[model samples]
Target: MSVLSRLFARHVKPEFGKPGPRQEGGDLPPHLYGVIAEFGKPETLVHAVHATRKEGYQVIEAYTPYPIEELHDAIGHGPSRVPLLVLIGGIVGGLFGFFLQYWTSVVAYPLNVGGRPYNSWVSFIPITFECTILFAGIAAVLGMLVLNGLPMPYHPVFSVPRFQLASRDRYFLLILARDPRFRAGDTFRFMETLGASLVSDVED
Candidate 1:
Protein backbone atom coordinates (compact mmCIF):
# COMPACT_ATOMS: atom_id res chain seq x y z
CA MET A 1 0.00 0.00 0.00
CA SER A 2 1.02 3.63 -0.60
CA VAL A 3 2.03 5.85 2.35
CA LEU A 4 -1.35 7.67 2.30
CA SER A 5 -3.29 4.35 2.05
CA ARG A 6 -1.31 2.82 4.94
CA LEU A 7 -1.93 5.87 7.10
CA PHE A 8 -5.66 5.84 6.30
CA ALA A 9 -5.84 2.09 7.05
CA ARG A 10 -4.74 2.77 10.60
CA HIS A 11 -8.06 4.52 11.30
CA VAL A 12 -10.28 2.03 9.41
CA LYS A 13 -11.80 -0.98 11.21
CA PRO A 14 -11.03 -4.41 9.80
CA GLU A 15 -14.03 -6.43 8.47
CA PHE A 16 -14.92 -10.07 9.25
CA GLY A 17 -11.45 -10.97 10.43
CA LYS A 18 -10.39 -13.20 13.32
CA PRO A 19 -9.78 -10.65 16.07
CA GLY A 20 -7.84 -11.47 19.22
CA PRO A 21 -9.76 -12.20 22.44
CA ARG A 22 -10.06 -9.40 24.97
CA GLN A 23 -7.91 -9.62 28.12
CA GLU A 24 -10.63 -9.29 30.79
CA GLY A 25 -9.30 -6.86 33.46
CA GLY A 26 -10.10 -3.63 35.35
CA ASP A 27 -13.80 -4.33 35.98
CA LEU A 28 -15.22 -3.09 39.34
CA PRO A 29 -16.31 -6.13 41.32
CA PRO A 30 -19.99 -6.06 42.29
CA HIS A 31 -20.69 -3.09 44.55
CA LEU A 32 -17.64 -3.68 46.71
CA TYR A 33 -19.98 -2.38 49.39
CA GLY A 34 -22.92 -4.79 49.19
CA VAL A 35 -24.18 -7.76 47.16
CA ILE A 36 -27.57 -8.35 45.51
CA ALA A 37 -29.52 -11.49 46.26
CA GLU A 38 -32.43 -12.74 44.14
CA PHE A 39 -35.50 -14.36 45.67
CA GLY A 40 -37.88 -16.87 44.12
CA LYS A 41 -40.94 -15.67 46.00
CA PRO A 42 -42.31 -12.22 46.76
CA GLU A 43 -42.30 -12.77 50.52
CA THR A 44 -38.71 -13.97 50.40
CA LEU A 45 -37.73 -10.93 48.34
CA VAL A 46 -39.46 -8.52 50.71
CA HIS A 47 -37.77 -10.14 53.67
CA ALA A 48 -34.42 -9.91 51.88
CA VAL A 49 -34.83 -6.17 51.24
CA HIS A 50 -35.60 -5.59 54.91
CA ALA A 51 -32.68 -7.77 55.91
CA THR A 52 -30.26 -5.99 53.61
CA ARG A 53 -31.29 -2.60 54.96
CA LYS A 54 -30.80 -3.73 58.58
CA GLU A 55 -27.30 -4.86 57.57
CA GLY A 56 -26.54 -1.20 56.67
CA TYR A 57 -26.26 -1.19 52.86
CA GLN A 58 -27.13 2.39 51.95
CA VAL A 59 -28.13 1.91 48.29
CA ILE A 60 -30.75 -0.54 47.14
CA GLU A 61 -33.24 -0.91 44.29
CA ALA A 62 -36.01 -3.47 43.80
CA TYR A 63 -37.63 -4.42 40.48
CA THR A 64 -41.06 -6.04 40.38
CA PRO A 65 -43.78 -6.67 37.80
CA TYR A 66 -46.40 -4.44 39.40
CA PRO A 67 -46.25 -1.62 41.90
CA ILE A 68 -45.24 -2.95 45.29
CA GLU A 69 -46.25 -0.24 47.73
CA GLU A 70 -44.75 -2.01 50.72
CA LEU A 71 -41.40 -2.42 48.98
CA HIS A 72 -40.86 1.35 48.90
CA ASP A 73 -41.37 1.46 52.68
CA ALA A 74 -38.95 -1.42 53.09
CA ILE A 75 -36.27 0.24 50.93
CA GLY A 76 -36.83 3.81 52.25
CA HIS A 77 -37.40 5.46 48.87
CA GLY A 78 -39.02 8.89 49.00
CA PRO A 79 -42.26 9.66 47.18
CA SER A 80 -41.52 10.58 43.56
CA ARG A 81 -42.87 14.01 42.54
CA VAL A 82 -43.38 13.17 38.88
CA PRO A 83 -47.11 13.89 39.18
CA LEU A 84 -46.25 17.52 39.94
CA LEU A 85 -44.65 17.70 36.51
CA VAL A 86 -47.87 16.45 34.89
CA LEU A 87 -49.90 19.04 36.78
CA ILE A 88 -47.64 21.84 35.59
CA GLY A 89 -47.88 20.63 32.00
CA GLY A 90 -51.66 20.47 32.23
CA ILE A 91 -51.86 24.05 33.58
CA VAL A 92 -49.61 25.37 30.81
CA GLY A 93 -51.56 23.54 28.11
CA GLY A 94 -54.86 24.83 29.43
CA LEU A 95 -53.61 28.42 29.42
CA PHE A 96 -52.20 28.11 25.91
CA GLY A 97 -55.42 26.53 24.65
CA PHE A 98 -57.52 29.34 26.13
CA PHE A 99 -55.24 31.99 24.62
CA LEU A 100 -55.34 30.38 21.17
CA GLN A 101 -59.15 30.30 21.18
CA TYR A 102 -59.39 33.83 22.53
CA TRP A 103 -57.01 35.27 19.93
CA THR A 104 -58.77 33.60 17.03
CA SER A 105 -62.39 34.21 18.05
CA VAL A 106 -62.27 37.53 19.91
CA VAL A 107 -59.34 39.43 18.41
CA ALA A 108 -58.29 38.00 15.01
CA TYR A 109 -61.77 37.38 13.57
CA PRO A 110 -64.60 38.77 15.66
CA LEU A 111 -67.85 37.65 14.04
CA ASN A 112 -71.11 37.65 16.04
CA VAL A 113 -73.02 35.44 13.60
CA GLY A 114 -75.57 33.80 15.98
CA GLY A 115 -75.83 36.46 18.69
CA ARG A 116 -73.15 34.50 20.62
CA PRO A 117 -70.49 36.30 22.64
CA TYR A 118 -67.01 36.38 21.04
CA ASN A 119 -65.41 35.31 24.30
CA SER A 120 -67.73 32.36 24.84
CA TRP A 121 -66.55 30.61 28.00
CA VAL A 122 -68.74 27.51 27.52
CA SER A 123 -67.49 26.84 24.00
CA PHE A 124 -63.84 26.95 25.13
CA ILE A 125 -64.19 24.61 28.14
CA PRO A 126 -63.99 21.38 26.07
CA ILE A 127 -60.95 22.58 24.16
CA THR A 128 -59.23 23.57 27.40
CA PHE A 129 -59.89 20.18 28.99
CA GLU A 130 -58.61 18.36 25.89
CA CYS A 131 -55.41 20.39 25.87
CA THR A 132 -54.89 19.80 29.58
CA ILE A 133 -55.19 16.03 29.20
CA LEU A 134 -53.04 16.02 26.09
CA PHE A 135 -50.18 17.87 27.75
CA ALA A 136 -50.42 15.81 30.95
CA GLY A 137 -50.26 12.52 29.03
CA ILE A 138 -47.34 13.70 26.90
CA ALA A 139 -45.45 14.95 29.91
CA ALA A 140 -45.93 11.73 31.86
CA VAL A 141 -44.64 9.55 29.01
CA LEU A 142 -41.66 11.77 28.19
CA GLY A 143 -40.79 12.39 31.81
CA MET A 144 -40.73 8.68 32.61
CA LEU A 145 -38.58 7.91 29.58
CA VAL A 146 -36.12 10.70 30.37
CA LEU A 147 -35.89 9.86 34.07
CA ASN A 148 -35.38 6.15 33.36
CA GLY A 149 -32.59 6.94 30.84
CA LEU A 150 -34.59 4.90 28.39
CA PRO A 151 -33.84 3.96 24.81
CA MET A 152 -30.80 2.61 26.60
CA PRO A 153 -29.32 0.68 23.68
CA TYR A 154 -26.46 -0.35 25.96
CA HIS A 155 -26.44 -1.27 29.66
CA PRO A 156 -23.86 -3.05 31.82
CA VAL A 157 -26.56 -5.19 33.48
CA PHE A 158 -27.28 -6.83 30.14
CA SER A 159 -23.83 -8.42 30.36
CA VAL A 160 -25.08 -10.53 33.27
CA PRO A 161 -26.84 -13.63 31.95
CA ARG A 162 -29.33 -13.95 34.85
CA PHE A 163 -30.36 -10.29 35.01
CA GLN A 164 -32.96 -11.00 32.33
CA LEU A 165 -34.91 -12.73 35.09
CA ALA A 166 -35.90 -9.34 36.49
CA SER A 167 -39.00 -9.21 34.30
CA ARG A 168 -39.99 -12.78 35.14
CA ASP A 169 -40.92 -12.81 38.81
CA ARG A 170 -37.37 -12.41 40.09
CA TYR A 171 -36.39 -9.82 42.71
CA PHE A 172 -32.86 -8.37 42.85
CA LEU A 173 -31.11 -6.02 45.25
CA LEU A 174 -28.31 -3.93 43.74
CA ILE A 175 -25.98 -2.23 46.20
CA LEU A 176 -23.90 0.44 44.52
CA ALA A 177 -20.36 0.75 45.87
CA ARG A 178 -20.73 4.36 44.80
CA ASP A 179 -22.00 5.01 48.33
CA PRO A 180 -19.74 6.88 50.76
CA ARG A 181 -19.15 3.87 53.04
CA PHE A 182 -18.37 1.07 50.62
CA ARG A 183 -15.58 -1.53 50.81
CA ALA A 184 -15.20 -4.23 48.11
CA GLY A 185 -14.17 -7.49 49.79
CA ASP A 186 -16.21 -6.90 52.91
CA THR A 187 -19.28 -6.20 50.83
CA PHE A 188 -18.85 -9.41 48.77
CA ARG A 189 -18.56 -11.55 51.89
CA PHE A 190 -21.62 -9.92 53.41
CA MET A 191 -23.69 -10.59 50.30
CA GLU A 192 -22.67 -14.24 50.27
CA THR A 193 -23.90 -14.55 53.85
CA LEU A 194 -27.17 -12.89 52.82
CA GLY A 195 -27.98 -15.96 50.68
CA ALA A 196 -27.23 -14.58 47.24
CA SER A 197 -27.92 -17.42 44.80
CA LEU A 198 -25.25 -16.26 42.36
CA VAL A 199 -22.98 -13.35 43.19
CA SER A 200 -20.86 -12.02 40.35
CA ASP A 201 -19.27 -8.62 39.98
CA VAL A 202 -21.76 -6.15 38.45
CA GLU A 203 -20.01 -4.05 35.79
CA ASP A 204 -20.96 -0.53 34.94
Candidate 2:
Protein backbone atom coordinates (compact mmCIF):
# COMPACT_ATOMS: atom_id res chain seq x y z
CA MET A 1 0.00 0.00 0.00
CA SER A 2 1.08 3.57 -0.60
CA VAL A 3 2.24 5.82 2.25
CA LEU A 4 -1.02 7.71 2.26
CA SER A 5 -3.06 4.53 2.18
CA ARG A 6 -1.05 3.16 5.08
CA LEU A 7 -1.49 6.36 7.01
CA PHE A 8 -5.25 6.13 6.64
CA ALA A 9 -5.27 2.44 7.49
CA ARG A 10 -3.57 3.21 10.77
CA HIS A 11 -6.52 5.30 11.96
CA VAL A 12 -9.39 3.19 10.62
CA LYS A 13 -11.57 1.93 13.44
CA PRO A 14 -13.13 -1.50 13.03
CA GLU A 15 -16.52 -0.09 13.95
CA PHE A 16 -16.70 2.34 11.01
CA GLY A 17 -17.45 0.56 7.77
CA LYS A 18 -15.11 0.86 4.80
CA PRO A 19 -15.86 3.55 2.24
CA GLY A 20 -18.17 2.42 -0.54
CA PRO A 21 -17.33 2.36 -4.21
CA ARG A 22 -17.74 5.51 -6.30
CA GLN A 23 -20.93 5.92 -8.36
CA GLU A 24 -21.81 8.21 -11.20
CA GLY A 25 -24.68 9.49 -13.35
CA GLY A 26 -27.85 7.54 -12.55
CA ASP A 27 -25.99 5.30 -10.13
CA LEU A 28 -25.11 8.26 -7.89
CA PRO A 29 -27.49 9.58 -5.26
CA PRO A 30 -29.19 12.83 -6.27
CA HIS A 31 -28.24 14.52 -3.00
CA LEU A 32 -24.50 13.88 -3.24
CA TYR A 33 -22.72 17.21 -3.58
CA GLY A 34 -19.18 16.75 -2.22
CA VAL A 35 -17.09 14.87 0.35
CA ILE A 36 -16.36 15.81 3.94
CA ALA A 37 -13.68 14.41 6.23
CA GLU A 38 -14.03 14.73 9.96
CA PHE A 39 -10.93 14.95 12.12
CA GLY A 40 -10.70 14.34 15.84
CA LYS A 41 -8.41 17.24 16.56
CA PRO A 42 -7.42 20.64 15.20
CA GLU A 43 -3.82 19.57 14.55
CA THR A 44 -4.98 16.67 12.43
CA LEU A 45 -7.32 18.96 10.56
CA VAL A 46 -4.47 21.34 9.81
CA HIS A 47 -2.30 18.51 8.59
CA ALA A 48 -5.10 17.23 6.41
CA VAL A 49 -5.63 20.66 4.91
CA HIS A 50 -1.95 20.98 4.06
CA ALA A 51 -1.84 17.50 2.56
CA THR A 52 -4.96 18.21 0.50
CA ARG A 53 -3.51 21.46 -0.78
CA LYS A 54 -0.25 19.77 -1.70
CA GLU A 55 -2.32 17.35 -3.78
CA GLY A 56 -3.45 20.33 -5.89
CA TYR A 57 -7.05 20.56 -4.73
CA GLN A 58 -8.06 24.20 -4.79
CA VAL A 59 -11.74 23.90 -3.96
CA ILE A 60 -11.27 23.01 -0.32
CA GLU A 61 -12.78 24.45 2.88
CA ALA A 62 -12.28 23.76 6.57
CA TYR A 63 -14.41 24.34 9.65
CA THR A 64 -13.59 24.34 13.35
CA PRO A 65 -15.44 25.12 16.55
CA TYR A 66 -12.95 27.82 17.42
CA PRO A 67 -10.37 29.81 15.49
CA ILE A 68 -7.09 28.22 14.44
CA GLU A 69 -4.73 30.81 13.01
CA GLU A 70 -2.50 28.16 11.49
CA LEU A 71 -5.42 26.71 9.55
CA HIS A 72 -5.72 29.92 7.55
CA ASP A 73 -2.11 29.56 6.43
CA ALA A 74 -2.56 25.84 5.78
CA ILE A 75 -5.60 26.59 3.57
CA GLY A 76 -3.73 29.37 1.76
CA HIS A 77 -6.38 32.05 2.29
CA GLY A 78 -5.30 35.39 0.92
CA PRO A 79 -5.35 38.55 2.99
CA SER A 80 -8.80 40.07 3.39
CA ARG A 81 -9.75 43.26 1.49
CA VAL A 82 -12.19 44.49 4.16
CA PRO A 83 -9.59 46.90 5.59
CA LEU A 84 -9.12 48.46 2.17
CA LEU A 85 -12.86 48.88 1.82
CA VAL A 86 -13.06 50.50 5.23
CA LEU A 87 -10.22 52.90 4.36
CA ILE A 88 -11.90 53.91 1.11
CA GLY A 89 -15.18 54.47 2.91
CA GLY A 90 -13.50 56.56 5.55
CA ILE A 91 -11.71 58.74 2.99
CA VAL A 92 -14.87 59.34 1.00
CA GLY A 93 -16.87 60.16 4.10
CA GLY A 94 -14.22 62.50 5.46
CA LEU A 95 -14.02 64.39 2.18
CA PHE A 96 -17.78 64.61 1.85
CA GLY A 97 -18.20 65.77 5.45
CA PHE A 98 -15.39 68.27 5.20
CA PHE A 99 -16.69 69.68 1.92
CA LEU A 100 -20.24 69.90 3.21
CA GLN A 101 -19.05 71.77 6.26
CA TYR A 102 -16.91 74.07 4.10
CA TRP A 103 -19.77 74.78 1.70
CA THR A 104 -22.36 75.39 4.43
CA SER A 105 -20.21 77.34 6.88
CA VAL A 106 -18.49 79.54 4.28
CA VAL A 107 -20.82 79.86 1.29
CA ALA A 108 -24.31 78.44 1.98
CA TYR A 109 -24.91 80.21 5.32
CA PRO A 110 -21.96 82.27 6.40
CA LEU A 111 -22.52 83.12 10.08
CA ASN A 112 -20.71 86.35 10.88
CA VAL A 113 -21.49 85.65 14.54
CA GLY A 114 -18.33 86.81 16.34
CA GLY A 115 -15.90 88.17 13.74
CA ARG A 116 -14.28 84.73 14.00
CA PRO A 117 -12.99 83.01 10.86
CA TYR A 118 -15.84 81.71 8.67
CA ASN A 119 -13.63 78.84 7.43
CA SER A 120 -12.93 77.50 10.91
CA TRP A 121 -11.44 74.07 10.15
CA VAL A 122 -11.47 73.34 13.90
CA SER A 123 -15.28 73.23 13.95
CA PHE A 124 -15.30 70.82 10.97
CA ILE A 125 -13.33 68.26 13.02
CA PRO A 126 -16.35 66.92 14.97
CA ILE A 127 -18.56 66.27 11.94
CA THR A 128 -15.63 64.94 9.95
CA PHE A 129 -14.77 62.49 12.72
CA GLU A 130 -18.38 61.36 13.00
CA CYS A 131 -18.74 60.82 9.29
CA THR A 132 -15.47 58.91 9.08
CA ILE A 133 -16.54 56.58 11.88
CA LEU A 134 -20.02 56.05 10.44
CA PHE A 135 -18.85 55.26 6.94
CA ALA A 136 -15.97 53.06 8.05
CA GLY A 137 -18.22 51.14 10.42
CA ILE A 138 -20.82 50.58 7.71
CA ALA A 139 -18.19 49.57 5.21
CA ALA A 140 -16.58 47.14 7.65
CA VAL A 141 -19.89 45.44 8.39
CA LEU A 142 -21.18 45.36 4.81
CA GLY A 143 -17.83 44.57 3.31
CA MET A 144 -17.38 41.61 5.67
CA LEU A 145 -20.84 40.32 4.85
CA VAL A 146 -20.30 40.65 1.12
CA LEU A 147 -16.83 39.16 1.15
CA ASN A 148 -17.79 36.26 3.37
CA GLY A 149 -21.11 35.67 1.53
CA LEU A 150 -23.08 35.98 4.75
CA PRO A 151 -26.84 35.87 5.35
CA MET A 152 -26.59 32.35 4.05
CA PRO A 153 -29.46 30.66 5.78
CA TYR A 154 -28.53 27.39 4.16
CA HIS A 155 -25.46 25.54 2.96
CA PRO A 156 -25.11 22.08 1.44
CA VAL A 157 -22.47 21.13 4.02
CA PHE A 158 -25.15 21.25 6.66
CA SER A 159 -26.83 18.30 5.02
CA VAL A 160 -24.30 15.92 6.55
CA PRO A 161 -25.73 14.48 9.78
CA ARG A 162 -22.45 14.63 11.69
CA PHE A 163 -21.61 18.09 10.44
CA GLN A 164 -23.61 19.55 13.30
CA LEU A 165 -20.65 18.61 15.48
CA ALA A 166 -18.53 21.04 13.49
CA SER A 167 -19.84 23.90 15.58
CA ARG A 168 -19.26 21.91 18.74
CA ASP A 169 -16.19 19.70 18.85
CA ARG A 170 -15.24 18.06 15.56
CA TYR A 171 -13.16 19.81 12.89
CA PHE A 172 -14.04 19.24 9.23
CA LEU A 173 -12.28 19.39 5.90
CA LEU A 174 -14.29 19.44 2.70
CA ILE A 175 -13.24 18.67 -0.85
CA LEU A 176 -15.68 20.26 -3.25
CA ALA A 177 -16.71 18.42 -6.42
CA ARG A 178 -15.99 21.48 -8.51
CA ASP A 179 -12.28 21.12 -7.88
CA PRO A 180 -10.32 20.31 -10.99
CA ARG A 181 -8.42 17.54 -9.25
CA PHE A 182 -11.53 15.90 -7.82
CA ARG A 183 -12.47 12.34 -8.64
CA ALA A 184 -15.07 10.77 -6.38
CA GLY A 185 -13.10 7.69 -5.50
CA ASP A 186 -9.67 9.27 -5.55
CA THR A 187 -10.58 12.23 -3.39
CA PHE A 188 -12.46 10.03 -0.98
CA ARG A 189 -9.45 7.79 -0.53
CA PHE A 190 -7.15 10.78 -0.23
CA MET A 191 -9.20 12.20 2.60
CA GLU A 192 -9.29 8.77 4.22
CA THR A 193 -5.50 8.79 4.25
CA LEU A 194 -5.49 11.94 6.35
CA GLY A 195 -6.63 10.09 9.47
CA ALA A 196 -10.24 11.20 9.23
CA SER A 197 -12.47 9.74 11.94
CA LEU A 198 -15.37 9.76 9.52
CA VAL A 199 -15.51 10.44 5.79
CA SER A 200 -18.94 11.05 4.39
CA ASP A 201 -20.62 12.60 1.37
CA VAL A 202 -22.06 16.08 1.42
CA GLU A 203 -25.44 16.63 -0.20
CA ASP A 204 -26.77 19.56 -2.13
Cα TM-score of candidate 1: 0.74
Alpha-carbon RMSD to native, per candidate: 12.2, 11.4
> How close is every model to the real structure, measured as TM-score?
0.74, 0.81
lDDT digits (tens) for residues 1-204 of candidate 1: 685343333223221122212223245453232345666677766777787788876566676756676898998865555586688879988998888899999999998959999999789999988999999889788766654556567655556678789888776767655543345656666666766576665555
For model 2 the local lDDT of residue 44 reads 96
Q: Model 2 over residues 41-69: C-alpha lDDT tens digits?
A: 99999989989999998768899999999
Residue 102's lDDT in candidate 2:
94
Off-target runs (Cα >4 Å) in candidate 2 are 1-32
The deviation in Å at residue 11 for candidate 1 is 35
Q: Rate the local accuracy (lDDT) of all candidates.
A: 0.66, 0.80
Task: Report the number of backbone clashes for model 1.
Answer: 2
Ten residues in a row with the worst lDDT in model 1?
Answer: 13-22
